[model samples]
Target: MTAETHAVRRGSARSHTVPTATGGGKRRDIQGLRALAVGLVVVFHLLPSLVPGGYIGVDVFFVISGFLITAHLVRELESTGRVRITEFWARRVRRLLPASLLVLAVCVVLTFTVMPAITRPQNFTEIAFASGYVLNWNLAASAVDYLNATNPESLVQHYWSLSVEEQFYLVWPILLTVAVFIAARSRMRAPSTRPLSASVTTRRGVLAALLLVFILSLAFSIYETARSQPSAYFITTTRAWEFALGGLVALVPGLRLSEALRAALSWIALGAIVACAFLFGPGTAFPGSIALIPVIATAILILVGDSRAAFSPQRLAHVAPVQSVGDLSYSIYLWHWPLIVVVAANVSAWPSWVRIPLILVVTYVLAVVTERFVERPFRKPRGAFRRRSVTFGTMAASIGVIVTVTVLATVGIQNAVDQRQDDLQEQLSGGGSSSSECIGAQAVYNDCADPFAYTDLVDPAFAQEDGPWAWFDSELAATACSSATVGSWVERSCAFDGASDDDPQVLLIGDSHADHIASPLQRIAEDRGWALRVETRQACNPFRVAAESDDENAARCASWGADVIAQTVADPDIDVVIVSTRGDSGVWEANAATAFRDLEAAGKSVVVVSDTPNVDGRQVSNGDLITGPACVLAAGSVDDACSWDDERRDTWVEDTAAAEGVPVLDLRSLVCPDGVCHAIVGGLIAFSDENHLSGSYALSLAGWFDRELTPIIDGASARG
Candidate 1:
């Protein structure tokens, strides 16, 4: 949402003064710009393909915020000789917090009633972060976390941009005050016969400081985006440059052009913005050099005077429809995302044609109501909220209530989860129970015996505990040995050292799919007295191929795979190599075959593990990845909602294994049986998310895995 500012009336003549913090008429053109920016963001979220680069709307808002806020700060300093920090902050609180808090409260209520129980804790935590104005950092952390990386879009994910703006609001005023102070001190130190204009000197000082910050921050943004793209996208350090650019524009003295020239530049700048939105997509490395396109365009649009020339961009921007959207931009931004998420999660069966318009219309109506009732009321003068103490107190109370409720709800959910886990453990401990027959593949497509005859298809006690999500706490995730992204490779070697150093050295390599099997492999290595080394990356395969659309990640994956191959071939101690990956992509076959050939040529035996069954029909509701177990827990006997066709298992991996004369260890029976895959087998949750096997389930396969794997390794070693 654009920062709240008083609307400026359109200039009637060319000589009219531009809008400023101290004294100037409103600029309807800027409001139209706000409308345009929010429109892009809304459309992008609704139909991403239609406006691929619509996310740049956030950059537009950032620039607008920087310009307007900086102008106000400079004007206050010029008019009053000192900045009122408390008053400045109070004004910001009054303008932004009421609607934000109202929306947050509504989202929290929905989280309890409509959101999946599996994601309530995370949603609550995000709510707390959003309320505290630190959602950006929270999101930045999640961006780098492998487990959280693919999390469904959060209702409050959009709050990250608001967090960034709020942070800017907090710090920018303080920085300006410091600059003004420094300028005053420098003027006092100078022995001058003639007095200098303090306002001009202060403005110059602030501008110079802002320019330096802009350059440094922009450089950092570029460097960070290259080094860590995910982190760069959300962190404040990488985004400060956008705001600094706006501040620079605000600080410029008497920036004016002829009406014709201004109109021409505005149109070109607007076109550049629309072009960036259409051309860019998720693959684009953002807020780096590429981000310069939109940032610069937004700045130019703001810089061009609001001239009402015929066919002028300003005149078009000032249209009533556009202005209305702009007027409600803040509330629209706050309301739209959560509504989109909620609707998508709950009403996904509704066609996109039906869903998109409904989402927009509902969002607009809510925005109007919130803008009128919530935002405007708090901001009005001579109201109860006008008093700084009342405003601050109300804000504090609102935040306190949100945090308190979130914490209580999280605790209650955790308790329920704990109790459910205890029940599962009890069931497992009771060895010869009737439930054992229905465990694993036997339970699939078997109406002969009821697995939950004694209990429930999904246990009633643990049904609301988010059983599938609880599986994330498994050993594999806790260790974090696998690569999170393309370039993040960490070598993890587990050597039993039970006998001599000459013990059979085994190497496990692949993507996160390989990492999921690491716990069981490590257990086997310790028990069997073997040296096991794991080298895996998220989404990376051991074979050299373009597995991902991101060129950098694909190249890195290829390079990493090549290095692993070279090392495996060179080491005489390496007796066996095991390759595992999510075989969802057929492109992986060629690479797997190549790795197999090279390893066999070096006299090292190879075994390829079959890819596991993903929860085929699962839906990611409201940013939470709903798994089979989660679905079953939510609605008992979901009629194969969580199962997939076992026949569709990745054939390329199997084919490569067959061609290379290596044993292909098909774990399909363990995960999916009788042509159907189930979400929960026995009492254990199967998959963590959609594809990756839960650590608990994988570890539970230790017995079956060991029994099946020993003979193959033994035969291979005897031949060697």
Candidate 2:
């Protein structure tokens, strides 16, 4: 999911209830919770291996936000008989936007100056989305996208939680308003003799609505997490339950316990929160059942009421240091992530002990400065900044400026990318004059005609200017010809290689790896007058024993694979079944062997393509995952600087093909020459990310592909 940067509630009084401009007191215990939540997140970011579940801190913030915001709204409704939506929104703007926009502006400047050109476009887009409080939807879409899923995290990735909170702020007041109206109408319709007042009726109605929302959202969260974990994590609907749980605590009455009982519950809640932060991890199916640990714990702590007992957890929370950190929590959350990302990007190997302290000191300094100069000034009611219109106008202008600058920067970067693509294309076309002599399996590995070569430059451009790497999606991904989401299967077929109703049918099957090669294969199919049907899924291997976890995806992939095999066997016109995947290890080889054997028994010829070498050197910088090629390019180093020298001896495909007596195609020689896998080969960026091939690189292999495939297809046709 996403991280949220929550502002500390500003007030002078000391009480458990949320503070309002009118009168409610401060909750030092709540501030301590804020300190604890941010502390977990900061530590998690600094040393994730040490605190694997620190991400749960974000959920804690969500619960705190829901409880506090709901309490404030309910208080307003009780006092005024109606919620002031605009005034509430104005206060939120004053409290949150100034600090948030400052961070965005600084991040944008850093993106253009220090971040890689290839990553700027995406970051800029995210900046725009974050500014508009819709980053969650953008992240949700990217999360489910098979190609985008592998992308390194964004600098603004943490903004999704803030976006979620803002969305709640926008809608919750409107819902309360409606509830108030219903309550008022009900009270009016009741006899004048009725005992219940309008406020009581309204409160009951609001409580009922909140309860319904909490139930529905919690159920959706459970279902969606099981079905599509990635989407579930970022989507507002799945996360609304956590917020609603907090709201229920605020709206529901008679929840306060005796001081002794409260203290006990408080300690239990604190233990639960701490235990979750230590125990939960990435592999944990989050915000589902596991998320209840942190969410419920946070809710319980809020409901227990802050106690002054010597042994009370609230007393510990009320300590000066914790309250101080809580005071700086918002600005610290805003500053820390980008700083970490920038530092990591530049010096990824920095030890955590050193990095953590450095990040903390710098983030604290910046946060203190921002909070004093930016946050407090606008928030105080003693100056010109106190004007509601001034605060609202300033917030609006700051957002507009961020959007404008991000757009201009993105457009400029895209233009540069387009120009570089054109130049690369020209060089590639001219270099291909010797294609006849150099375009084959043997010539591909040596100093043959390098279409992507740049003679004048000292280093190859590691980042693909225009290819799969440039945009994570390839031709197949763009066309939606394969399954890109989890637990969902959509069999998409398209005619390729000028194949018509009478042409021989060729079926391509497997996962995303199969889809990556579809471009070159499409050209081959068109040249040979064959119809190519591509059947693939995000992580589905199409193996007899599915390699994926035994979840919904595994079941769907198993069923999908069986249906595809049956159709291939049943269709007499289907001449060959081509299988390829990213790797050959695990259960894939076994599954591939079974599929090949089944096709052979059905009198269908099978072609098994060996998996490509995966170069693993990408590092997380400033939140984004910078690829080896991009890193090398940014450093102005030769391709060897990022090249992988070790041999990938996984010949599972060849071994399985031998066992099954099927034809095999190995593209290793073409992609990795002289037993070395380079991030950039010839003049083109070799890989889309670490594992998948760039569309341009894959397309460049068309000549060699046709050379090897023609014999297999011809022999199959001859046999037929």
Candidate 3:
């Protein structure tokens, strides 16, 4: 649906100087570069797990943007003898803002229509922050989060990069202006007959300085990419170098290289980019050595492709489809992501087959409308109003929308679907709490007033400041804080006393989630009268162990998990090795299978506990049911909300345990009943927030483990 809006006036005077497109190439080369970068990003986003290296497309875009923007700025400075900052910004606003604001507006509307009231408030706040151009900061504060789920305002997470570039333009122009002022002043004061080479030398010097900064920043970015991929991926500081590198490339006056070198370089650059694309899928090292390929490839196209080149890529880039995409690239980039995210969030299912075409069609339509209407009018010659006032009015309109959205989000948050929490007041008011009597009672301790039995269930407080069951245990709040504070570790202070040299053995090793399970392990060890030995770290899943990023802590955790397993197996005195940890690539699951194999070969009894369910790693309990009536309405169904899915139960938890040749305990079924999962079982809350079981609930589950583990222990001796 396309809407036509009226013209608005700019603040004051508008710079009338129009930009002169420089450096003739068959427009194809530029278009091809744009196509390649955009296609890579789209594919990567559709299936990041499949294309780990595809994210390099953003870097590619940065380089292209840097080159184009710098080239334009340099040309203007040289021709006009002055760069008009206002006009530059006006052009930027016309080109970028209209489409962006439209996307934000759509996201806000979709969020209201589709997202659950419980989560909608947070999403709205995120969207407002994103609109205000502080999304990077907002996301950085959250850190390492992949905003792919049903977030209220997450439709536009990808816009953070655009925000970074916008921010760059905001500051870069002033710096360029300073450089221009200096150069012009120097030229005027110097002898008029000075050789033209002097101008070339001055440009070269400035370009050289920019190049040094770019190189140095790139080095830092590479280091950080390995150390903290998430930070390196998102933060602007680490990324500025790519843009600067492109700007540096633009500064070179004459690229008169031999055709052989050009072709060789082009082929090499193309090979680098293609290689990175195929081999460097998602989760691969990035902004590191891997990034150089695409960045350099983009540079090759800009530098080597010219009118004389026999097989210039410019023709390819300039094709109708490519140019169309390139023309609306800004708008396509802005609108496509949010549309895809919102559709995914609302639909609750995503597959490449469906999503790929959907994103393309939606992006094309949005981009075309935004370009034809919102953008062209403000920039083109118009008699109704001055461009500067229109720009000002647009800015004011955006801020006004921002204010309105912010207020609505606040009100929505304040009035987030309220439940009859009074029922909760009565349950806690009574003696202790009622035991959960649901069908899955064995798997769920909530039937026995076990607070942690439903740790995976959503709670009411989720919509409130404190969340559901805030009264049951303040530790729910404390635990989250504690989890964050533990930091990433190579080793941790044991939660329980260590087993003596002569005592029957207890082996503990796993990831951060496993560490969280330490509370339960300590109780089990005490009840069984065994020494507890634990080896675990934050984010170090024992299943797939690999040292990928530059985070020192991840490295330490990887080494520790392997060493701990080897040492436990070597000890003949150790009777039982309990290898429990969160599984999967996220927590270094690569090493888990080997760790289990070694234990089995050593003839040590290994018990691998399955991982609990979590949303974005945050523990969610059924407590969300208390504040809203959605669960109440869907109370009788065997659908997802009422029943645990196979992914959480069989795949992540059960599959890992079974693969390692250990007894797999499916706890989810025990916690949910009648196809309904409740965060609070019986009258007691199960999970503190999402996954971590409350201390009391964990203690209560000890007997269930005793029933299961006792049989395993009894059978081990007889079999041996």
**What is candidate 3's CA lDDT for residue 178?**
69
Q: Which residue pairs of candidate 1 clash?
A: 8-26, 8-27, 9-26, 53-277, 152-623
Give lDDT tens digits, candidate 2, residues 1-720.
111222233222332332221234566777888899999999998889888999888888888788777777777887888888988888788888889998998989888787755567678899999999899999888887666666665678789989998999989899888987887787778787757865687678778778878889888888888887887888888888788788777765544245566667788989999999888888878778778888998988776656666667888877888888888898989899998888765666677778778889999999999989988876654675667787778778889999999999777766776676555444434544664333222236445655334323222233433344233225744563433343543344444533566666678887767777877787677778877778776566666464456667768777787787778888887777888765543456766677777787887788888888766444323234345456445435443445556477666666878787887787776666667665555555667666777766676666677887887776776776
Better of 1 and 3 by TM-score: 1
Q: Model 1: how far is 309 from its true place, Å?
A: 2.8
lDDT of each model, Cα atoms only?
A: 0.74, 0.71, 0.58
Preferred candidate (lDDT higher): 1 or 2: 1
User: What number of backbone clashes does candidate 3 have, counting pairs of residues 3 or more apart or in separate chains?
Assistant: 67
**Candidate 3: tens digits of C-alpha lDDT, residues 193-263:** 65544345446445655676687778888887866665566777777788887887777655445555655
Misplaced by over 4 Å in model 1 are 1-22, 183-196, 352-354, 381-390, 425-434, 441-507, 522-533, 545-576, 583-605, 613-615, 618-636, 644-654, 672-685, 713-720
The lDDT, on a scale of 0 to 1, for candidate 3 is 0.58
TM-score for predicted model 2 compared with the true structure:
0.88
Off by over 4 Å in 2: 1-23, 190-193, 252-258, 381-393, 423-432, 435-492, 497-504, 546-549, 583-591, 601-603, 618-636, 645-651
TM-score to true structure, per model: 0.84, 0.88, 0.66
Tell me how many residue pairs clash in candidate 1. Answer: 5
Ranking of all predicted structures according to lDDT, beginning with the best and ending with the worst: 1, 2, 3
Best by lDDT: 1
